[model samples]
Structures are given as structure tokens and as C-alpha cells.
Target: MLPRTSFPSAYRAAPTLCRRCLLRSMTARGQQSRFISTSWLEKQDEAKRKWEERAKLIEEGKIQHIWDTFKDRGYVKDLAGTEDQIKELMVQKRIGAYVGIDPTAPSLHVGHLLPLMPLFWMYINGYRAVTLVGGATARVGDPTDRLQSRVPMKKTDMTMNITKIHYQLKRIWLNVEAQATRFGYEKEPRIWNRAILNNSQWYASLSFIEVVSRLFKGMRLGPMLSRETVKRKMEKGDGMSLDEFVYPLMQAWDWWHMFRKMGVRMQIGGSDQYGNIISGIESIKYLRDTEPDPDQKLSDDLSNTPIGFTVPLLTDSSGAKFGKSSGNAVWLDQFMTSTFDLYGYFMRRPDADVENLLKLFTFLPLEEVSEIMEHHNQDPSKRHAQYALAYEVVGLIHGLEEAATVQDQHKGLFSKGGATEVSSYPTGGPPTANMASAFRVDIKLPESLVLGKSITRILYAAGLADSVTDANRLTQHQGAYVGGAPGQPAATNRGISTGELTFTPIKNWFPQDTRNFLVDGKLLILRRGKHFVRVVEVVSDAEWEASGMMYFGEPGTGRVRLLRDALMTGAKEGEGHDLSALSSPEARRDFLDRAEALYSDEAGRFKGLPSEAFMVKKTRARQILEQSFRVFARSGNQSAQAKTAAIDEVLERAARNLDGHVENYMAEKKRQEKKKIRTSRPADEKSAVRWV
Candidate 1:
């Protein structure tokens, strides 16, 4: 089934012009509409008119462009197909190719896409394409590169993952089909005849004897043992199992299946999968020869059905295999990785990777991509190529409008740094997704903003502090900040709750002061520190106290008491001293001083503090502030100092602390240097030096 558009109205408005249609329309009418830019239309015309010329270039298999593209993008020698081999293949006729994706995980990662590109290119260039899902094979677990043995998947989980994967593939294939079909043959635009097939459909009904018979027919035991992936594991005493040994044979069977069922002649994937693809081709050759005349040669025309190609594994400029980001694999699902995070990841890709990624991922003309690359290389700070890559990928996957939305939100969150710039709605309404990473929702302020709401109540309502005491400790440490402004003193424990708080990039947003609050447009994102973030909105008191609600505010009194008790209990258990110990004014002052030190030096001591010990101290201060609420009620007026001055003080203090740390380190280095000199002196001279 074709993938359904999430928003049909969008396609209706735009008329869903595929590349082929656009090209044909331009050639026949000799006019370009706004939707079909004049330059883009001209380029399409040129490419279509001169298809044979490029075909010859491809036929000659001059791989300079392909090599340059891959090399610039950080790929080195590929696992199987070399630069020379790919060049030779390109000179050949339109190939029928297949890429097998095993739904080992619920979703495909960016790593998987690297290998999928060769098949995609084949489809785009008028070759038949097939995407084979390993629903049957997933249960067997292809033990190729795994260091440790993986637990076999349950049939149920494997089925579910495959279903989800099938849906994702449908979306990707449809998008690719639209682009690929549009790129060539404008008069009779070819529709991509892509298939998402389940191997289980073909293999499930086969008996064990049948499977065994086929498995041994084309399989070679010696070559299987000789495979690098298998040999290395065996040499390391990892003990390759029979199933692991038979993995290539089963994979080969997939190619053979495609060859027979779909008349697919080629198998393309990552270099790592070369063994499997080659094996599959051999299996097909063996099966065809052994079978009857009509089935012996599946294709009469070699040009249309010629087989086998694989793309190089994508990597970064550092040669690190391209898949992991911040130690996690970059998944296609929004839930797995935010759109913004995805964009940001692509946006920061090295120049080398950008050129190759464009060839692999984007349908943008090679010439235009090259132009972008040239400009990007000239001035990398502009990040034109990265942005282009980000734009194209996001647009292809999520659509142009969604991509645009994500880009805008990225600017607002990172560039502007607060919720005021974003659209504010009541919380519980549908969330606004940006760059596919962050979500914006409506958040109502607590009654404390206008009313004489207590600090504990406000904190509780905002979900910042658990209890009044928890609020107090966070406030005491200066850990909690509203709209990038520090909270008031702890004496007046009544928290003034506003309807919205935004999670903006405050400290890291260009530059800022101790407090620079602006309700940019409508959104209110509050940043607590380098990491803690909250996005919220303000609402009327009636809304704050409303009942029969989906999301309601916490009761002011109960919240405060809960916070205070929680803090008190924590302090008693974690800290040696009880809350009563701080009853004396002098003791309270000392405790406050210690709290100040802890807060100021948090970054330095963050790693050293035991989790329980830190929580206890934080809670104790919170309880104190909650109990002595009156002390914190004083609202300090905002200083008229320049933003730079306010920010400079904090930056300078931090700098000085860092400088002091460096000085101590230097002194230690000097001590070590002197000791080394003394130790190196002759024995008699060393003794004399010690006496001196």
C-alpha cells in the first residue's frame, strides 16, 4: 500500500508535482511556474535531454566523481566493492537491485541508511528496486559484527518490530519514489515500482527439509569460515556457532528469492554485506543452472537485469563510523531522536561527510550540491552545506512545512533563548514539534504570581521543587532560576508562580546578564542551568484554581508542607546534624555560608558529592526556607545595571575561580619539575643539595 500523507491538504495545495511531471511540463510548455523555479526547470530539461551522455559516462565506469564524493565525505576503502569496481559497473545497463533490512530493532538508524543509498540510487536511475524485510531472518539474528552473542528475539517482538519497520519503509520509499520518478522521463514519468516484501511470506511455509536442502545447495563451508567477520571472532576464542556460520547462506537465499520472484538481478548494500550479496548471487546461479530452460536465464536482456553493487559505509571527518551521536544511535523515529537534534546532528556534519551525504540522501542536482560545497568550504562558519543537508533530509522525511517549523523553533530556542518568542497555549493541548526534537506546549501559571501565593505552593505548582523544603534548598544553592533570573531570598517562602516558563538557551545564548527577561512573542521557555529546562505559560487565577481539569495546580498549603517534611526527613537521614542544630542564629549563618559555598562550587564538586548526601543538604535548606517563609518574601528590585555588567560579574567570578585552579596546578607542576631536577643529580651532589 502507498504511504498516506499526514497532511493531505498540503499536497492538494501544491498539486504534488513529481520530478518527472515537472520536467515534462517545463519541456512541453517551455514555461516555469513559481512552484517550478526557472533555473531548476532548465536544469531538469538539460539532464533529461542529455541522459544518454551521462549514461555513457556511467557505462565507461569512470568513478572519479563517485570516489571524490565518497572521499570528500570521509569514507575510506569500502569493505567489498573498490573504487575501480564501482566505476566498471556504472558503465553497464540499468540494474535491478535489492537491499535487505533486518528489523532487528523497532526502527532503522542512520547507520542503516548509509548502506541503503546504493539501492536508492539504483531505483532513481530507472532500475527496479526492492526492499526486503527480514521478518523471518530477524528471529535467527545474523551474527556478523557482534562481539558478544545476542539473545535470540521472541517471535512476537520480531513480528512487531517488522510491522513498525514496514510502515517506516513505506514512508521513505514513497518519498523516494516521488523524487526518483520525477528525475527522469518527463513525457511518461515512470512510477517507482518499489516493493516492501517479508521473507517470512516465502520462507514460512517451507519445511525444515526444504530449508536444509536449499541451505547446503549453494553454500561453501570453507569460504564461510574464511570470512573476516567470522574468522576474527573464532581466533579470539569467541566460538562461532552453527547458526552464525549459516547466516551468510540464509542471506544469500534472500538474493536468490528476489531474483526468482521479482526478477531482481542485483543485490546492493553496505560493504559489510558483500559476503551475503555475493553468496545470494552464487545461489541464484546454482539454482538457475540446476532448474529448467525458461528459469535458467531469468533475464533475456543483461542491460536491464544485470546484478550486484554496494555503497561504502558512511563516516565522519574523523573516520568514526557514522551512526552514533553523543553515544546513542541516531534513529529515524521522532521519539528516538528529536527533529531538531537530528537537524543539529546533520547540520554539524564535517564538510567531507556533507558532499557524500548529499549524493546518498538528497535528490538535489549533483552540480548544485557541488556549488554549495564550494561555497561551504570557502566559509564553513556559514554552514551552507550543512544547512542544505539538514533542510533536504528533514523536508524529505517530515515534509517541507514541518522542516521549516523545526528550523524556526531551533532559531527561537537556541538563538532567541526563551519561551516568550514561541507560541504560548494552555498545557495539555497538542504539542508543537520543532526540528523533530523539542516540544512546545501550553503551561498555565500558578495563582502566586498575582495572588499572595506562597513560595512552596508556586514551586509545587510549577513542578520545579517537590516540596517547600526542596524548593528552599534549590533556591538556597541558587540552582533554581526563573526566566534566567535568580529566585528571591528564602525568608519569604511563598513562591510567586507565573503561568509559563520557557526552556531557552540563556547562558549559552549569544551573551546575557544575571537577568535579561523578554517575552519575545508568546512562548515562555525557562532555563534553570546548563541543563535543566522548563517551558510553561501564564494564566488567570480562575484558570489556576479551576476543577474538572485535565491538568490542575497543586494545593498551595499541602505542597509547602510536603516539601518541608520531605526536606526535613532527608536532612536527618543524610546529614549528621538535624534541622534543630541550625536553630541558633549563628549556626544558621554558618549553614548558610556553607550552602553558598556548595552552590558556588557546584560544578567543581558535582562529581564528588554522594547522591544521597547532596540531596539531604539541598532538602534541609529547602525545609528551612519553607518554615521561615516570611524571610524570603522580600522581592528584590531588578538592578538597572547593564546586561553586560550583570553578566560580566558572574563570568569574571567563574574565570577567577578557573584561574585560581590553574595557578594551583602550575605550582604543583613546578614542584614536580624541581623534584625531577634534584633526583637526576649525581648521588654525591644530590646528598649535598639535600644538606643545603
Candidate 2:
């Protein structure tokens, strides 16, 4: 060891230095540190003082009315500021409020609806409503409830998602505005004040250095580290990422930007976002309090200070969260979830939850809601409350017209006396005499596949079941039904014995005399369960064979084969396959042979194949064609001239075949008519009518 005299003075004094003094020196140095500046602490004190003042106003009952509307409807779960502060800000001016949505998906789900309701209320109440799309931040991936970082989205996909979400937002706003009017909110929303912004606009130009220098300085590591999300991740040893840790800082920047530019003083989000909301409020306070001029300090003014409001997370009766993660997300986009399915989702809600759902989801008056509930409680099986809930909510999301259509469809399928058992042959005529009230067919099946096929095979072919085994299971479990009309029952019976169609349970096989089962000798309705119903129109054998041949004669078979190979080899899901591929003439011939085999019998008529087998072959052929089209289109390998020539050839053949079929059909009909006329004539006149 070196001699003490030779050591540095600080090292020599280490043993004798007092622990308290050392800690004091470190604390003093920390206060002046650049990351957590002294001014930030002062700003915290100022915020506390303002909170105390707001609390006093709240105690005085001055701010109670401000939150009453939201509280009554269960919209308010947590609020950043006291009620008085919110009241004061609203009373002073038409301040802006916003909710940010990350385009993690192309469509918003029901979970997003809770927070959005407050924004809609604000807009109609004459406040500026801002919907911020997280174009830039979505790229970062919100780490709020995730155990792992999100898979980074491709640039193209992100762009598409952003565009779709923007359109959805606009559409939803229009829907809400229309719904509000029907709910008796006469004041029209200021459409001009509603803004849909993409944060990428500013983030694209924002430099990393600028973000760190300006925004990060106001954020403290202690609070961020202590957040429930961060702490949970750390405790679980999952290891948090730097991007996730800095996510709140970016969100803070968003709020600050909106506050300064849009006069937005409020941010609304889900209760899980409480931590992020706090960070935003702190950021606004820090930036405002640090302003050089005292007169320009917005945080010092009560009305100017930003606030955050959060609604409860939407959940089921089991208390599980409602979202994609839970695998139960009900999407607002019609393409993702049809209006019929959406209406059914709410209709299926338990009686215990319907009343609360009505209160939360609809804008019907409380008195009306209570009266409806009382009536519903008297006869719960009638589902009066569920119908009201389903109708109003469906009307709100999808227009009232769509809601009405779905309602009629639902009633037609399930209402009492809507269907009658077919135990005996019809007393009068077939149900199809009055075609106006015939059940609308949702899918069309080839007659060759349906007339003698098993019920299980029909279900699989109609896309109602995943596989033949699944279809069999459904039938065995009494989950399959055949025959039901989709329109309201006719008021007049006419010659028909039953004015309403009836669904009869089907087992392993369809009836051998399927003509009696068919409506107008064509249409068949198949129901898998209470929720899934499909009406199939059985096309003639001639039409079926012609359609298959037409598909086969189409151009670009080579490209389609190549695309199918690429897809089979594990191309990414949703990858475009529009480019052309080099293929041999032999390959084209082989493809045509396979298509011909699917529908052609030894006698050259349509084959009597099971619907499942027919559909499988048809689907495989179509997939290959579609895949090829997509690949060649994307690759641009095929020349326009060649594609056009192939299309023209196919269309010419198809048209010729169609004309021949029509002529044959008309000729057969005329021969039948002549036979009828001759048979009805008297014996003496019949002998004279036989020359032709």
C-alpha cells in the first residue's frame, strides 16, 4: 500500500468524512443536475398549490355539475384535476379536448367506444373535439399493457392502417352527430372545430437531439420507473426496453403540442392510461412554468392548465378486458364485423349486463331507460332490454337503416310462428308462389352438389363449418337446421298453407325428395346455430358446368400457378401475388383438365359430386387464379397485350356458352308448353293438333 502522505487529500479524508455530510453534498449536487432541474421541482409545488385551491372550490359545490353528466353515465373513472378546475376552464372558453388512438389495427373496436363517448359529448356541447391518430407513436408501439415489445409494423402497412383509421374516425363522428340529434340533442356540433390530426406531421421533422434536449429534460426517471407498467415488467424480470421507457415522454410531447397549437386543455383516455396522463400534465406544467416571462406563464393561470379525464376499461361480466388480446374484440368496421353479427353480439349479452349497457351505450333519457328496464324485468325472456340496447347501439354505429334491416332479419329467423314444421306435404302450393316474401339467399350452390348430398357436406361447402368433421359434429349435436325464410311473414295466406317458413332440424342426410324441401325448387336455408344462418340458391347443372369452364378458360394460368407455388412455400400472409410467371403450355393443359374433371360426368353432364368435394376443388382452382393475378399484377412481368388477348378469348367462349344455354332452356320450355296444350285439347281436336 502507498503511504498516506503520498495519497490524494480526498482519499486520506474518506474514513473521517461524516455520512450525513457526504449525502448532503450529493443531494445539493443532484438538485442542480440537468436531467431533473430545480425548476421542475418548483413547478410540482405550484401544481400542488393549484390542486389545493381546486379542492376548496369542489368542497363549495361549485364544480359538481361539471362532472355530473359523465359520472351519471359511468363515463368518468378517474380525473387528473379537481372538478372545479374543469368547470372553470369550460366556463371561461370553448377549450379543446382530445383522445389519441394508435392505429394498431385498421379498425376501432368496442373497447375504444367508452373513451370516445366523452369526446362526442364535448363536441356536441360546443367544445373543440380533436382526434389524434398516433401515426408516429404507433411505430414506437405503446408498451402500456404489453409484456413484450410489439412486432415493428412495415411502412406500407402502417400507412394503410393510418388512412383507414382516419376514415373510420370521420365516419364515426358523422354517425355520432346523427345519433345525437335523434337522442334529442338539438344543438348541431361545430363540424369545423372537429379535427383529425396525424402526429407524424410534426414527428417527421422533429430531430432526436431536439426531443432529448427539450422534452426529456422535464421528465423525471423516478416517477417513470415507479409507474405500475414499468414496475411490473421489472419485477417480472421481463426486462423493459428503452423505447418503452421513453414512450410516456413522447405522449407528453403530443399533449404539449396540442395544448399550445389547438387550445386543447383536456385529454381523455382509458383508466389504464392514468400514468401517461399524469406525465403529460407534468410536461405541460414544466414547460409553462419555465417560461421566461411571468405574464406568459400559462400554468400559473387555472383556466390554462391542462387536465386529463379517463373512462373505465370496457369489460365483460367475467371482468376480463375487451380487446384483441382477449380474442373478443367486436370491431366497429362493417367489413370486419357485419351489422347482423354486431347486432347479435349485443343481443346475446346476459340479462344482468343489459341494463347497465343501455345506460352506458345509449343516449336515451334516464327515465325512458328505467321504464324500459322495468318492462324488461317483467318478462326477461322477451329480451326487451336487449332489443333496445342492440337497436340503439347498432343504429349509433351503423346507420338506423342498417339496424332496421338486421332487426327484421333477426326476427324472421327466431320469432314465434315465423316458421312451421314440414311434417306433411303442402296443402296448396309451394311457399315460392309469392316470391316477394321468399327468404333471401346468401350463397348459391350448384344443384349437382346439393340434390343428393349429405347435410354435413352441404354445411362445409357453404362455409358454415370449418371441415366435414366439424359439420358432422354440428349435426350430431342438434346444431344444424334446414329451411327458414329471412323476411317478415306475409299477412295474406293466399293458397299457401303456411304464411311463414319453418326450419326443421337436419341430421346426417338431407331428405331424398329435396324438391319438397326447396323453396320454388331452388332455394335452401341452412342454419348452423342461433347465430349463423345461410340461404343457398341451387343453380342448374348447365350453369354450374359453364361457370367452371369459364373460370378455367381465363388467361394467366401460368402466373396463377407460380403465385400458388410461392404462397404454398410460405410467402408472408397478405403478400400481393399479381405478377406473371413463366409456365409451360403442358401446365396450362393440365390445369384445364383438372377444372373439367370437377364438374364433368362420363355422360358429359354435370357430375353428381358432394358439395364439399365440389367446393374444395372449385376453391383450390380459384385460389390459384387469384394468387397468380395478384403476383403478376404486383410484378408487372406480363405484357398488357398478352393479358388482354387472353381475357378476350375467355370472354368470347363464356358468352357463346351462355347464349347456347339460354337457347336450350327456352326451347325446352316451349316444348313443354306445347305438350300441355295438346293434352288439354279434346280427343277429336288432339288428333288434328299432332302434325307439328
Which candidate has the top score in TM-score?
2
Candidate 2 lDDT, 12-53, residue by residue in tens: 345544556656756887788867678768865664565466
Query: What is each predicted model's overall lDDT from 0 to 1?
Result: 0.55, 0.67
Output candidate 1 Cα RMSD.
19.6
Worst 10 residues of 1 by lDDT: 506-515
Candidate 1 lDDT over 480-559, as tens digits, reads 55442234322322222122112222121211221134232222334333322344444556775674332324443333
Question: How does residue 582 of candidate 1 score in lDDT?
Answer: 61
lDDT of 2 at 331: 87
Best by lDDT: 2
RMSD to native, candidate 2: 24.2
Per-residue lDDT, model 2, residue 603, is 22
**Residue 158 CA displacement from its true place in model 1, Å:** 1.6
